[model samples]
Target: MDASELDIVDRPAASARGWRVPLLAFARNPAGSIYGTVVADSVLAVESERQTKLSDLIYAELITVIVYWFAHVYADFLGSPPSGSRRASLHRLAVTLGHEWSLVTASFFPLAAVLLAAAAGASIQTAALAGMWTGVAALVLWGQLAGRRAGRGAVVSFAYGMTAGLFGLALILLRVLLH
Candidate 1:
């Protein structure tokens, strides 16, 4: 099972471990659970409200995954092959997939979490700011990975920017329409 699935199954166990230990553990490994918590919460909220069919919810999550994949590719491997490199092409493919995986891990999870938090009555300021920061961090990583390729970096950055913007827009629309 995926990390999110694991979290759902273990949340009771974690709670049984006691709130204090879990809180400390959460504080210690903030990044790891933060995203999973968000996605799980969002999934639960949607499932609870019956606003979306299960198939559609899964599809939406898949789109979020795709966005991350593009963002990663735009960030990491957009330039010419490295110098004196016999494995340049292979490295390119590998980085491309790595970026895709990063999207699954980094970007979408956080976005989903923010959305879930908002649904759970988190303060608007908290959800919006957290989401923005998380999305920006992902974009920054993408740009940094893009390195010296001016055009490539710009493209990748733009894609991620758009991804983040869409995330915000979707959340807002969902909030208004769902309630």
Candidate 2:
């Protein structure tokens, strides 16, 4: 669903409860987060296997996310009905980019986890693992939020969380199998 489809009442209530409303709203439409987490995790897995430097791994993951974000924005803008004029087209492009900004922001937590772990003197491989796990945790949290937002019960929400987490696990498994 697009941003317009979000439940307007939910945002205000979540904000009143001291929840991070933007993050929760993003969770309510988790395609970007899921895409970002998968991409970041896959990068971490591959870089770790190569024993890449922490800096290089971080750069690679960041660049990858930005590139993918731009690609998504471009595709979305192109797919949308064309505006009448050049200025209007540019404005539409900007709006599409803004709408898709979550794709880049969603990688923040996982990347931060890598940075923090590396700063704490963890090996590059260990830090990458931390990042991967952070991505998995984020996916699970997003899934739970989505399920609850959809009015699902606790058990169903938990199941949703598990289903989302399995994506991360599958990536990890692929890394293992490759190496």
Candidate 3:
């Protein structure tokens, strides 16, 4: 059949929910947390000579998260600005940059939660667990939303959510094992 003779699929207008693209982009950008955990755990494990406190471990991990987050943000900022003749007003530019930067920043929230919990005198182990779960939950929710947007059924969407969570967790496990 000639290309023009094929029927078009009725679909969503791309401009609608345009914000979702960036929101998903922000949600998906946090691989560094795993890397940070591994690095922090390994360094603290080796350097302390004695056992490190749970608070200390989580704090160190949080620092690593921030460092990796910073690198990611800086790199993105360099690549994020609009190119060529496309120009935005100062306010638009500010908003664009803020949204772009959020992609890198969102990953830190989980670790920040851990930090706050620890500061409040919670056990590092417990706080870390909560933080990790928070991140995983975010991933799963994002996945579910994504699947729904793609017209998946409820079961399929739930499965997609678990898949996203498990995939991220697997990467985290791999980093932990390797480090």
Candidate 4:
């Protein structure tokens, strides 16, 4: 089904519970979730190494995701054929942005992890690590969901999950190499 169909399935519930829609959208946009998580992890790794404060780190991560989301939306909107009417063009822009909203939503859990860890009195570094791991876990979960959605068996699904987790690991490896 196309994005419009997916939007029809999600838009009403999304309007009712804005915060929850992204989690639901995950099934439809696993790639967006993975992309967001990888980006979040990269930001966390780099900022944590800088010994940044938790508040600053969180703000930076959020702003980074938003900027990327806007960029993705703009690129997608540009790639679409130009609509005839101005209203139609605006609608297309809205649809493109809404479709890419998963990028911002995917960062929610990892940011929450960082906030929760800090609330529990963890150091900024440790809290950032928690957030990074949460992103990794999200990636793995998205992979498993995708596999199952495709009717794969449990073992193969798990392998897919691990493979997705590798993206996070690669960022971690880069962190280690840089530091």
lDDT of 2 by residue, 1-179 (tens): 66765767456776785755767655435667777788889888888878558878888889999999899888888788978999999998887777677777778878999999999999988888898899899889767776877789989988988898998888778877887
lDDT of each: 0.48, 0.82, 0.54, 0.83
Q: Write the per-residue lDDT of candidate 3 for residues 43-152, one digit (tens) a residue.
A: 33332333247646645655655565567556654666555544544455555445444333545655576667778886655565556656566667666766776789
Weakest ten-residue segment in model 3 by summed lDDT: 42-51
List ranges where model 1 is wrong by over 4 Å: 1-51, 80-86, 107-179
Which run of 10 residues does model 1 get worst, by summed lDDT? Answer: 26-35
Candidates by lDDT, descending order = 4, 2, 3, 1
Clashing pairs in 1: 38-113
lDDT of 1: 0.48
At residue 72, give the lDDT of candidate 3.
55
Error of 4 at 97 (Å): 1.2
Candidate 4, 6-32: lDDT as tens digits: 989977867896764555555467777
TM-score of each: 0.32, 0.83, 0.47, 0.80
TM-score of 3: 0.47
- Which is superior by TM-score, 1 or 2? 2
Report lDDT (Cα) of residue 14, candidate 4.
72
CA deviation > 4 Å runs, candidate 3: 1-96, 175-179
**Local accuracy of candidate 1 as per-residue lDDT tens digits, 100-125:** 45335544544565576678876544
Model 4 has an lDDT value of: 0.83
lDDT score, candidate 2, position 25:
59
